[model samples]
Target: MRAAIGVWRWRRNPLRRTTDLVEAWVALVAVALLVLAVPAAGWISGTRTDASLQRAVQAQTRQRPVTTARVVRLAEAPAPGTQSPESAGEQPARRAVVATWSAPDGTTRTGTVATRRELSDPGDTFRLWTDLDGRPVTAPMRPETAHAHATIVGLLTAALAAVFVEAARRLVVRRLTHRRYRRLDRAWAEAGPDWGRTGAGS
Candidate 1:
């Protein structure tokens, strides 16, 4: 807005320099890119990222399934006075337990796994995620998480675009200012001798 006003106010001024017009035009161009191009670039990048993440989510969900595991024994607890600060929180504490569960092929598998359940007795059941081969695996990415990642990517892209535009504008303006300064210096050098002499040029 200030750039537009500067352009209009200086349009008919006899004292206006070429650099002033160029600076105003540069500001206007930067504004146009920020207003129009930045959002488009961000949206396109975010859409592509979201689509790729969603595909990965689908693949993970299909490959991993929840299965029931029966606790055989609770693993050894930490020594007294050695617990982490997080143990005092309301969140359920995770503990390693030796558990057995049936594989997809109907074979019984037993392993030490971590669980948040308070059950300590054998035969206690808890849910576990495993690959098709019954190997323990983490849960698939949630759709909400994918969307959040996409949003962050979009915001970063937009911010980078704005930074680049401002940088270019400043670079061009700096060069113009230097050129103007050099011209003023040359003009002063040429007129310095006569400047202080009364009626020298007249």
Candidate 2:
């Protein structure tokens, strides 16, 4: 809006220089791009990102399966000061356990796994996610998490587009200003010597 007003006000003004008109036009173009192009870029980028992430989520889900493990005994706890929040908690969150389960290959597997249960005796069971080889793996990504990642990428892309447009506009304006200053200096130099001459204006 300000850019439009500037162009309108300078369109017919007698004192307006060529650089002023060009600057106003540049501002208007920048405003147009900011209004139209930035959102389009963000949307396109986000859509692509979401599609890719969703595909990855599907692949991970198919490759990993949940299985039940019977706890043989409580695994040795880490040192009191060395336990991370994820590994240390009195409540039922994530506690280490030595357990056994059947692998996809029909063989028995045993390892120290993390469980969200308070282990008191052997034979306690918990659900665990493992790959085809029965090696433990992290949970697959959810649709909600993919959406969140897409949103962040979209926002960053839009912000970067805006910054680029503003920077280009400022660079053009700065160059025009420098040209105007140079013209002003040349005009002063041409008229300086005759300024105080007798009958110079009469």
Candidate 3:
């Protein structure tokens, strides 16, 4: 739509200069790229990022297995009003406790695990995730979360592409303007000396 309005200079008009036609063509090409290239770049970036993240999530799910562990000992709880800002919104703050669980090879392993409940017993069972080495680890990433991340990356990429396109268009227009000014200056210099003559006005 914008390109349609800008290309009016290319229509038959006695007042239009050669530079006007060049600028109109430039605007047309810039508009074409803005409409075609930017979205293609964004989709490609997003799809690749999404695939990579999904693969990582699957690998982590396979490497980290969920196992049942018994709480062996409870750690000291934080003092009142001592919670960090990041955990302040969490209800019934989680506490770390030393726990023991059996590995895939039937070997017993002990590690600290965070629990929302206050566990004082020696045999309270809870589910936990463990890496291949039987070390405690966080849960696997959700597919929805990965998709959201990919979407944000795509939008950012598109925005940056748009900025670059506009910058390039402005640079081209500036160069055209400079060239037009130089041409006008030369034309004036050639006609300036004869300005006082009667026939020179033509």
Best by TM-score: 2
lDDT of the structure predicted as candidate 3: 0.78
- Model 2 residue 150 CA deviation (Å) reads 1.1
> Model 2 over residues 64-165: C-alpha lDDT tens digits?
887888999888963123233333354345567788988878788988777665653588887767789998776677788888999899989999999999
Sorted on lDDT, best first, the list reads 2, 1, 3
- Cα misplacement distance, residue 130 of candidate 3 (Å): 1.0
Question: How does model 2 score by TM-score?
Answer: 0.86
lDDT of 1 by residue, 1-202 (tens): 8878888877888989999888888988888899999998889889889999999989988898778989999877531232224344623566677889888777889887766667546888887777899987776778888888998898899889889999999999999999999999999999998997989889
Question: Can you write out model 3's per-residue Cα lDDT over 1-202, one digit (the tens) per residue?
Answer: 6676767746778888887887888888888888999998888889999999999889978998889989888856532232334344653656767789988677899766676575536678877777788877776777877898898898889889988988998998899999999998999999989978987767
lDDT, candidate 3, at 116: 59
- In angstroms, the error of model 2 at 29 is 1.0
Better of 1 and 2 by TM-score: 2
Q: Summing lDDT over every window of 10 consecutive residues in candidate 1, give the lowest-scoring window.
A: 78-87
